[model samples]
Target: MEILKRPMGDYQTNCYIVKIDDKEIIIDPGMGATEWVMANVKNPIAILNTHGHFDHVWSNSELQSQLNIPLYSPKGDIVLMQSSTWMPELPPSTPDIAVDGDKTLDISGIEVKFHHFPGHCPGCSMIEIGDAIFSGDFLFEGSIGRWDFPYSNAESMRESLQKFAKWTIDKPLYPGHGNPTSVRAEQRNVDYWLRIV
Candidate 1:
């Protein structure tokens, strides 16, 4: 398994391309990755979006059209995805597959598990492929996603954090922004941040 991160857009969102041999899966194809992914990543099987934030899904339509592959996002963030206030210039493109609940997807033999976490947005989630997790805005190096958006809920973030606390604390976490960090590191940070937030 090969995991590559390409930070893109004004926000410097982390766009990941996970490849296993010739099969590839893109997670969060943000702005500025359309040209790069079109040239480099080959025969992508699908796109797994962690959430519907504009910065995260900026290149969804471009990649989906060029690669002719399906894009999937958690069903809960449909509202945010469609709102121009949140999505900016990128008009909402309905995902081919809307992942509503916890399930495992078999993409040409590679297995990806989707777990809804809902905090940063209404339909926030984390994608688990192999031993790596595409956490989107959920867990960052020493911080969590912003829960101050109009659609974002502090209570939901708290609930998600509670569930996150029980998850295994050893996997690699690829966030939507910033450098990747381990679950153990974020777990400790979550403990400290939760007390103040």
Candidate 2:
């Protein structure tokens, strides 16, 4: 499996293209991502969203139309997927598949896992494919996602963090922003956050 990454739009949201054999899955196709994705992928299969935040799914509709593929988004964030209270100018897109919490499925022959962690938003999740986890805005290098947003819940975030801290298996973490970290590395940070709380 080969993963290609490009940060998009003003937010510099990291858009990823996970290539497994000839099938490619687009994850978090943010603002200004359509052109880059179109250029890179030859046999695109699916578009997966970590959450419904506008910055993370700006180019969702365009890519869906162009690539003619199904979109899998978190069921909890379905409201955010259709429209955003924060960004009314956001292009509205519909999800072909509304993924429930902690679900796994096969995209063609490849395994796609969605680990639900609702805190940053109603349906915030981390997508796992192979040995890497695409932790969209949840677990970053030295920080965690903010629960100060419109639909964000601090208590829920705390719960999610606790669950995350209990994880024993280590994997490469590709976050929404900044450089990549690992499960073990961020477990230490989770410990820090838990300590202060």
Among all candidates shown, the one with the greatest lDDT = 2
Best by TM-score: 2
Q: Model 1: per-residue lDDT, tens digit, 1-197? A: 99888899789999888999798899988888887777768678998899988888888887878789998988887666665674567756679998996879988898899988877888888899988988899888888988998778888888888888888648998899998888888877766757755
Any residue pairs clashing in model 1, and if so which? 77-123
lDDT of each: 0.84, 0.93
Q: Model 2 TM-score?
A: 0.97
Compared with the true structure, the alpha-carbon lDDT of candidate 1 equals 0.84
- What clash count does candidate 2 reach? 0
Model 2 clash pairs are: none
Worst 10 residues of 2 by lDDT: 188-197
Tell me the TM-score of each prediction against the true structure.
0.94, 0.97
Indicate the residue-level lDDT of 42 in model 2. 95
